[model samples]
Structures are given as structure tokens and as C-alpha cells.
Target: MAPTLRLLAAELARRCDQDGPHADGTGTGGVAEMERAALLPPGKLLRPLLFTESAAATGMRRADTLAAALGVERLHVGSLVHDDVIDGDTQRRGRPSVVARYGLPNAIVTGDALLIGAFREVAAHTPASVPDARRLAVVQTLAEAGVDLCRGQAMEDELRAQGDRDVDRYLRMISLKTGALFRASCLGGAQLAGAPAAAQHALTRYAEHLGRAFQMADDLLPHTSDTATSGKSALSDLRNARPTFPVLLCWHRTNEQGRAQLSALLAGTLPAETAMETLRVLLRESGALTQARAAARAEAAQAKAALDELPATEARAALHAVADLAVDRDR
Candidate 1:
């Protein structure tokens, strides 16, 4: 890892692990443990890093944003807990999901606790050095992003139930589901720093494009990697019948007869094992994989371009590298 990234990771490990509320008056501690399980061994720490980096790019002190960064990460983890419950995914980052290890009720409570804790992290934990107005803006930004996330999740479920396969709508949904939080992390960092409007917009744009690329890359994970490598069930997307980008791409690129079979497969008319195998074959042969990769790259390129609006700082340069990583990473 880069020196800056390594330091940030260490900081996050220390700060995030100790921040959860223990026992909530009942002294049960189970909810806190579930929250710990969901958070410890943090994956990527992408949002917090982005938060700190975006703040740094504004010539602000990175250390001052630590509480807010922690808040954003908690919000992210909370959302992931909900995602696991919604998808019935038993695993995450090679560990049992919060819902899997703890029952659904505890998982829900854990998620809610994290959500409540996240707001407190922002409201009560921010340094006195941060201005009141800017702090309010940051809070509003995170709240709005959280709303977008919920909307996006609902949109995804609607797509699955209605079998709506519009690629444009899919992009919008992912932008809301994924990009909104990225925006909050980056935008909130800028807000905490009292950054000028222009810098905030540029950083937010960069984050949104990076987020789109990241999600596109994520959609490719099951198609390209095994459960061990991807750290999740390979058939998760197909099992949910979630209309992911590559799946839609494959649908659009294939012949009419292939489309018919794909529909039948999605509808469970065909044997699941056979459908999974056939869909993988079609994704490979139909050029959809390559096309999907290209789209992710394009979004990454846009993310990099957005950095051009910022001053030539090392922090901005790091953001540029992260954009490439978003698309090029395997997991």
C-alpha cells in the first residue's frame, strides 16, 4: 500500500473498531458484536479513504475529518448489512454476513444501531474547529445520500420483480445506490473542510464517476471469478435475477433466439445449473464482457478527468490512481 493509504488504513482500523456503542443499556452486547463483525477487517476502506483524500485535496487537515470518515464508513457497512438481508447473501469479504451469523432481527437492529451511531459520529464527533453551517451541510448531504441509497435499492428490487431490463434505468439505479454514497463521502469531506463550491463539485463528480466504474466492475465479479476469489457466491446475482450491467449487455448483444433462452433462464423455466453455465458461456462469447469492461474504463477515465478541475496536489493525484483501481481491480 502507499504510505498515505497505509497510514489511513491503520487510523481507520483503530478509530472504527472502537467507535461502536456497546450494550445499549441492556448490556446484551450482541448487537455490538454483530456490528463489530460487519466492520472489523474492513474491506478496502474506500469511502473513508476517499473522504480523507478529498479533504486533503482541499488543502485541509486530514486528521480533522477522521470522525466524519468513520461516520460514512459506518453508514456504508450498515447498508451492506441490509443488502445481505435483502439478497439472502450468507457471506461477505469471506466471512459470515451479519444476517447469517446473527438472526435477521439482530441483523436489522445492528444495521439500525450503526445508522444511529453514524449520525452521532457526524453530529457529535466533529471537531469544534469545523464550522456549524458546514457541519449542517455535511449532515444534510449524508442524509440525502442515504435516502438515495434506499431509493436505489427499491429500484433494484422493482427491476427484479417486474423484469425491467432497461440499461439506462440500470445505470441510474446504480448511480443512486452506489454513487450517492460516494458523493456523500467526497462531498462531505469537502463540506467539513469548508472547501469552496467549485472544489466540492469537482470532487463529487470524480466520486460519482468512480462509483459508477466500481459498481460496473463489481457486476463483473461473479461472471469472471469463483466464489473463493470473488469472496461471495458466484450465482448470487443470477439467483436474485438482478438485471446487472453485463447481464443486460449480454441480453442486448445476443441474437433473438439467445435472448429468448436467457429470458426463460431468468424466469426459471430452464434448469438453474444449465442456465448458469449457459449464461456464463453467452457472456463470454457475446462480447458483453469486453464491452462491459470498456464501459467501466470509460467511467474511470471520466473520474480522472474530473480531477483536472482540482489543483495539482498529491491528493488529487491519488484520486486519479483510485479511479483506475476501481475498474482494474479483481475484487
Candidate 2:
């Protein structure tokens, strides 16, 4: 890890501890406690790190940025908890999922607590002691982004349920579900620093492209890696009947026989091993992995271009490193 990134992650992790509420009074206190512990592991911590690095690059003090960064990450973690429940997933980060460990109701409540707490943190720290309007604007932007994410997720669910196979539809789903948060993270960092509009907008573009690349990489990991490495079931997406970028690409490129194989996998009833094998075959035969890598390269190039507006500095370099890592990361 970069020195700056390590420092930022440590600071945000500390803030999360300080800002995150104890579960004792909540209905799902036990689950909340587990969630708390889960946050400190050696996972990517990508969103908070990105937010902090972006802010630092634009002259935001580490102290000034921590609360917002932590808040965003908390919101992200909350969403993942809720997502696991919705998808009926039983594991995350290689352990039993919140719902599996503490039942769905408690998991839901824990997620709600995180979201509410995130908003509160943003409200308390922004505006920088000026007129409160700017602070409110940040909150509003973040709130709307979260809502858009839910809408995007709903759209994806609907499409998959209806057996939609179009690549455009999948892109729309990823843009909203994944890209919104990325945009919000970048914008939030810039807003907190009172950065110029050009810098803010530049980071926004960088984040948007990086976000899509990140999701594409995430979507590709299952077929290329094992469950132990990915920290979740390798076949989970397949079992959930979700159509990822690679799968969508293969579906679009394959001939009739290959399409039939993919359709059989999508019947919402394949065994885990069979689904994994089908995905492997599709990726290999259709060259979907190659295409996915090329797409990621294009996005990474766009991300790098967006950084041209920022002053040359270690922090800017860190941001670029993150963009590169997003496309090349194994998990």
C-alpha cells in the first residue's frame, strides 16, 4: 500500500470506530457488533481510501476528510450487508454473512443503522462552519446517489428476472448500482475540501470510469479465481442468476450452440459446479476475458486523462495507482 493510502485507511478506520454506534441498544446489537469487527480486516477498503486520497490531493486536511470518508464507507458496508440478505448469500469476506449469522431482520436493522449514521456524520462535519447550505447540498447529493443505487439494483433484478440479455441493459445496471457511489465518493472528497469545480469534475470523471472498471473486474473474478481468494462463493453470481459483463459479452458474441449453453446456465437452476464450468467455457471460447480486459484498459485510460487537471503530486500519483489497481486487482 502507498504510505498516504495506509495513513488514510488507518485514520478512516479509527473514525469508523468512533462514529459507528454500539449495538447494545439496537434490536440487532449482536449482529451490529459482528459487523463492527468485520470492518477492520485486510480487504480493499477502496471507497474510503479513494475519498481520502482524492481529498488530500486537493488540499483537504486528513482530519477534515476522515469523517466524510468513514461515513461513505459505512454506507457502502451497510449496502453490502443488505445485499447479502437480499441475495440470500450466506458468506462475506470468507465468513458467515450478517443474515446467516444473525437472521434477516437483524441484518436489515443493522444496515439501516449504518445508513442513518452515515447521513448524520455528513451533516455534522460538512459546511466548514460557513452557511449550512453547502453542507446540506452534499447530504442531498449523497442521499440521491444512494437512492439511485437502489433504483439501479432494482432495475438489474427486474432485467435478470425477465431474462433480459442485452449488453446496454447491463451497463445501465452497473452505472447506477456501482458508478453512483464512485461519483459520490469523488465529489464528496472535493466538496469537503472546498475544491474548485474543475478539480471536482475531473475527479468525478476519473471515479466514474474507475467504478465501471472495478465492477467489470469484480464480475470477472469468479470465473478466474477460487472462493477462498475472492472471500465469497465463486459461483454466487451464477447461482443468483445475475448476468455480469463477461457473461453478457459472451452471450452477445457466442454462436447458437454457445448461446444455448449459456441459456441453460441461466435457467436459475444450475448446480454450482456446472454453472462454474459453463462460465469458464463461455469466457474461454468467446474470448470474453480478453474483451473485458480491453474494456478495462479503455476505462483506465479515461481515468488517467481525468487526472491531468490535478497538480502533479504524490497524492495525484496515488489516485492514478488506484485506477491502475482497479483494473488489475485480483479480487
Candidate 3:
């Protein structure tokens, strides 16, 4: 699994590098220097690689499979850049975020460029042997995912505006915001491989469960992991006022006095250190972390179960390993 995941990540990086045009050719004119400096170098590329492996497990030829995997990753990265701006984040992968380095407008354009570039890459590799309908379906699927991504963001914004989301509501919001892309990743991969409907459905289920577990782990990371280890701010989730699994869980389990403390923190008047301290106290006293961990474990099990529908193979084994990794990741 380690070797396969590494190879998948490397392949995704290679495709990302290949997809980029020269700096001058990237965004608008007169912005090439800034754009070049702000280029979001690829991250772990885990999603794309996993996606490609899923495709290969269904018998897609290696040469014909790379483009779709790269395309999927490009969409994921582009969304992240735009999402950072939306979330007012300043750092990513231990570096300045695109908006932080190049301003919001440029970051938006860069993300847009990545989106177009992804489609171009996908289109270029459509083998004549593959039906035109198949290519169109892939493109349409990606476009729909993009739309869902935007809808998810909008839903989060609505929740934030309300500012008093409960546990179930936050779960629903994050499920849409994060789970949609994971579903797309698996669905797209299976489609590219011409996998049977049953197989695709199983993979999609696996992705949704894994996505929920991944987000749960991510929500925990800000509180549990160090910045140096996580490659992002350790407390950004609280600082940004984003409702996470632990926060909601704590909100549910805490007594009135605890809720008052949390409410004060949410009111945005407390100092940063004090606010974080309050959050930590609420989480610890309410046993929210334990509950969140239990939920993640449950989701990871469900994700693994989804693989039961697939034929036993190295790829299936890797998928199960990934589920465990997602749930157990500390950073």
C-alpha cells in the first residue's frame, strides 16, 4: 500500500507539472511574475492517485488512465485555492495561500485557470477508441461536481450566517461540502475504467464514508496536532469560526455553563488564547473528542465494508489501507 500510494502521488505530481503552461501563459498579462511566484505547487496528491488505482483495478490501461486522474486532482486543487480565500485562510501546505500571496482576485483567476487546464488535459487524452459519449460523460460529471462544490460552499455560508448550527446540521453541511468531491473521485475513476454499476456504486459509497472520516480527522487535527507536523495552522478551525465535528459535539454534550463559555467564544470578543482555552475545556469536559473519534472509527469501518463488493485484489487492499490511514492520521 505504501509503494502504491507513493507511486500514485508521484504520478499526480507529474501530471500537475505537465498541465501547467509557462508562467506568462497562465493568468492574465502583466501578472505572470506574481502568478509564477504564487503558483500552488501540488500537495500530497492522494486523491488523484487513489482514483487512478481504483480505475486500474477495474482494468483501465495505464496510458489511457493518467489524464482523468490528473484532471480530477486539478479540480481538487483549484477548489482548495478558491476555498482558502472563502475561508480567509492565509496558509496551505506550510506555504502562503494563493490569496495571501497574490490577493483574492488573482487567486480566483488562478483557480479558474486550473479548472480550464484540467478539462483541456482531459480532452486531449480521450482515445478515439473510447466513445465520444464516454468523454462527454466524464466532462459532465466533473462540471456537476464543480457545481456541487459551489452549492456546498453556499450551504456552509448559510450555516455560518446563522451561527448557531447544531450537531446534525453541521454534519450535513460538512457531508455535502467534503463528501461530494470524494464521491466524484470514486465515481469518476470507476467510470473511466468502464466498471460495472455495482462496482461504481460500491466505490462511491466507500468514498462518501471515507470523506466523512477524513473530515472528522481533519477537524480533530487542528486541536490535536502541531503546526509543524500538520503543515497548516493548528488552531485555524477555531480561529476561523468554522463549525467542526468536535465543536458541534461539544455544543451538544456541554451543560449550560459550558455552553455560555462556548457562546462567548463564538461571539468573537474573547482573546485568541482565552477562546482556544475555552474550546479545549468544553471539548475535554464534554467528552466530544472521544465521541468524534468513535464516529470516525465507525465511518472508517463502513468505508472498508464498501470494498466488500469489489473483487479482492491489491488495489482493494490499498483502498482499505487508505481508509485506515484517513481515520488514524494525526496530521
RMSD of 1: 1.8
Best by TM-score: 1
Residue 189 lDDT in candidate 1: 89
Cα TM-score per model: 0.95, 0.92, 0.91
Q: Tens digit of lDDT per residue, candidate 2, span 1-331?
A: 3665576567756654654444555433364575574455635778877777788788876666666777787788888888998889998888888789889888897788777777877888643652466466667768977998899889989988988988888888888999888888888877777788999999999988988888988898887778888888887888888978899899888899998888888885678797788779878889998998889888888998899999997778888988888888667
Regions of model 1 farther than 4 Å from truth? 16-28
For residues 146-191, write the lDDT of model 3, one tens digit per residue.
8877887887777766885577777777677888778877777778
Measured on C-alpha atoms, candidate 1 has an lDDT of 0.87
Please list the C-alpha lDDT of all candidates, in the order they appear: 0.87, 0.80, 0.76
**What digit string (tens of lDDT, one per residue) describes model 1 on residues 1-331?**
2755676667667764565554555423566667778888888888888988898999888778878888898999999999999989999988899999998999899999887777888888888988889889988999999999999999999999999879999999999999988999999988888889999999989988999999999999987878887788887888888899998998999999889877987887766677889998989989999999999999999999999989998888888888988988767
- Residue 283 lDDT (model 3): 94
